[model samples]
Target chain A: MGGFGAEIVAKYNYWIYVLLMMIGFYAMIAKRNLVKKLLGMNIFQTAIILMFVSAGVKHGAAIPILDKHEVLEHGVHAASVVNPLPHVLMLTAIVVSVSVTGVALAIMQRIYRRYGTLEEDEILEKIGE
Target chain B: MSGNLHMFVMAAPLVGALTVNLAGRASRKAVLPLVLGFLTLSLVAALGTMAGVLEHGAFTYTVGNWQPPFGIELRIDHLSSLMLVLVSAVALIASFASLQSVAKDLADRQHHFFTLYLILVAGLHGLILTADAFNLYVLLEITSITTYGLIAMGRGRAPLSSFNYIIMGSIGACFYLLGVGYLYILTGTLNMADIAARLPQVNGTVAVATAFAFMLVGLWIKMAFFPLHGWLPRAYNDAPIGAGVLVAPLMTKVTIYLMLRVMFSVFSPQYEFFQHPDVQNLVVWGAALGIICASALALGQRDLRRMLTYIIVAEVGYMVGGVWLANGTGLTGAVLHIVNDALMTLCLFLVAAAIISRNGSLAFDRLQGLYRRMPWTMAGFTLGAFAMIGVPPTCGFFSKWYLILGGIEARQWPYVVALVFSSLVNAVLFFRIIEIAYFRGGKGHGHDDHGPVTEAPAMILAPLLVSAAALVLVGLATGPLVSNLIAQFVPVF
Candidate 1:
């Protein structure tokens, strides 16, 4: 029981991310509303971003930015700095996520305007017309 | 100096997209020539880069002068250079082919169509050239978004289908992103070669396995590999003829190339995951089933474009299965098929576009006596169809021969049988269309009157004929291509 508790605590972030991803995946596949699916997609993307951010965490490291005085006096060691690569990469990913969301929302608007419903089944039925 | 040429390969189409868009706004008439100029520039650059790669072998370009493990890298190797040339050449041909059809099908959205077309081509170029995993993801989304827009522009139900494609494509891209994140968590580098070097240290971990699963699933969805192929047929079927001409040929083929890249380049083939017999068996059998089912589905389609989309699904299975066979012969076949299938699909789709542009429909019934109405177009279609059926001396047969040889070497009898079965199925499929077009008398449509041969405009016919001739030329050139290009690049087992 103690081992289980420790394991859960140690990897809780991954568990949470998995839970969020599953929620998003379920909505994407199971939900009928296109907008709801899009929301799920956003949630899914955000969860991945969270995972990436968490992956960059070094338990006791300082911010990646260096102090001028410390740098001037003595060279800063890389060991004290948190990993910044994931953060940088995720910044690009976040922008991509936003663009995808924008395009998807616009597409949803077009879908709604054309079919008069955002429900997938209803849209399909209308398309069959 | 030569390294910068790779940058030009990607930039030319990008600049073309912008110039075409701006030119469209300024003078509608200027758009076509401007698009042609830019794409021509891009094709020339791609060819120049290909020559450089052939002479110098594989090299990497560090973007912004930042070195790898920190900066985005673009690796131009035999494989990528080969794909770059294929993509730009196809885009050039398809865009040229679009001259008449875009005017007809896309009445008002001609400018927007060309803009998105160029963007799609640029995105594909970027996808093939980028060496950073995250950069590949970004380019994948670019290609996909542009694709959704292009597909939505088609008449009737196209918007809905494009919406469906968006859902599937975004989910696929996100899955890929998550997989890349997993890899980043395991190894701190995003450069593919760097990650490949680092991955073997943690090679068999659950995290690595999960990453592989996620990435493969994501790419399979994108490639529309049989079971995950729900979004492809409708999107391709409902797309505007001009858009279909571009997307149907390039989209899935590029995804397949990405899958191969991830398999061989990003993850070293020596990894136990690739060597596991269970995984190999699963892939080969899954691909075999995909071929049979997709070919059968294609046989049932009445519409020409939809039928070819299913065949694309089947051809995708061929490449996947060949690569999974894990022998030099099989991987060679897969690589060769990548080039062969791209040209074959481009030819077929161009023929479809020509038919629809001139005759106004793609139904099998409407094709009765089409050979009389459009002789050159029919001739091109016949060449493409012969290639599809794996007739001897067409490029398609040589690739299949290599794939079958690989299957035999791997002792994958089912895959071999499936290939043979698919060829027969393809023969039936094409012959059925041929029978209707060539042998049958036009009854309801009165198309048999031997009407004046109104071939597709030179814009379309020229590319069609060039691609058709290319079918035979590439077939003959397969030996040199395999020896000079693919042999050096296929991973040493």
Candidate 2:
């Protein structure tokens, strides 16, 4: 429990995900740049993928696939089957998030054309104008 | 009709979506009737299906004839059948509203517009019918993505509003997926009935709480409840008139239906049998605050579109407050209001679209003295406005009446006050615009930019008149609807 260095390495990926989500939220609310905000949103959503993947992790797990149905079934002395469902769900969510980001970027492109700047302050100023 | 009418009930709209998309592109000259014909057919199918449910009992269509737990189920229980009919009925009205609006604005993009509109309708139908949680999420995205494209077709700030909506909508979908994942991890099943039966075994598990919180936040975001509703007003206001007619009226509502499904069926122990008074109190408090704050906000808005947006937010509070009251009357009111609110909101937005079409825009200042010039439009708006405020001789009143009675039954005073205050606030908000429209502008004629703006074209007018009629009809015939349709659908739990 007191092995600090080992623990950090073990859950390093999760920490990175948290950092990315925070950066996105920070950029969304704090930063003035709209392109950067969209970038932040993309990073934020990808962070959820990290969360889901980490939840699926097992220390001594296989890829959760086998030729025989018996191997997939629960057994007394069976190797831990890696959870394939989260991986599958994360795949769908990733596609949706990317589609949303693509559309957001398109909107950002339009906003740039109409307002002439992607910075929040400048855009609001222009909208006011 | 055949006894196996459930298949036709659900599949007709899906086929219509496909056919409309195909026909719109292939027979460009035939877009109007092609789309309208499909919507009208869907209406008949939905109503016939509802009638079947009323007569033949609740129907379940097993996809590919696969049984539950191993495969998906599409159920048309009293509640689901009722919701489907309401949704399709409004879609029919919206199609009429969209006909003229789309023709005038998007002649170049007619096919794409109708395609997306019908696909959105199909997605909505799929959402209501699906008995699998994952299937619901799939259909939810189908509507949301299509909704983004539809809203972006608006002329003014639609692109921006659509963008904001996408951001919030993505967060919501992800939250819902997270909840579904939690349920799957705990129960090892995706089918809703299977999950409900299995949930009792793991009633107080941490997974259940995680799933509940995830779903609560997710549905709140999707339904645009209070603080989470920042995206709604702009999206509703900015979308093209036709898009507004479809998306504004249905989007939040279908999400509300999902929330109800999850509350009653999926998270049965969480909402119903567990008897979580604290959670109930929290929801009631939030809904009350939403009603009060939104009404206040609506009172201050100068833009007609933005004002309608705020009213939508407040009205969500009405439904949430009613549902969370957790009584027979409360549940019935909440469920019935889902239909009533959709029709009324559709009426208002369609009429607003007509107003927008006639004038260059619907800014408050521009709407003055429109009463004499456009009596029919004004009358439609008046009906919608009165209905929205929950006044008498309208279905809107019954929803509030039941909600208040439920609140009183639940020994709730603040919510009753919230309902009353919200109604008054909206009255003040809407009447100011009417007063300006009737009294304030130059004598004997209209504004400078819009020269002698008469009533809108029939395509727009027909749908609006239909929605307005539905509001009055539902209000007048509240007893039969409450007893016959809604009570059977929404149980006390």
Writing each residue's lDDT as its tens digit, candidate 1 over B283-387 gives: 999999999999999989998998999999999999999999989999999999999999999999999888877888899999878888889999999999999
What DockQ class does candidate 2 belong to? acceptable
Top candidate when judged by lDDT against the true structure: 1
Q: Compared with the true structure, what per-residue lDDT tens digits does model 1 show for residues A1-129?
A: 999999989999988998999999888889999888888888898899889888788877899898899898999787899978888888988888888788778777787888899898988787775
Task: Judging by DockQ against the true structure, name the best candidate.
Answer: 1
lDDT of 2 at B63: 84
Across residues B154-268, which tens digit of lDDT does each residue of candidate 2 receive? 8766777787787778778767876887788678888888888888888876768888888778888998999899989888888888888888788888888898888877876
Itemize residue pairs with steric clashes in candidate 2: B154-B240, B368-B437, B369-B437, B395-B475
Give the poorly placed runs of model 1, Cα more than 4 Å off.
B272-275, B443-450
The residue-level lDDT of candidate 2 at B406 comes to 91
Model 2 vs truth, CA RMSD: 3.4
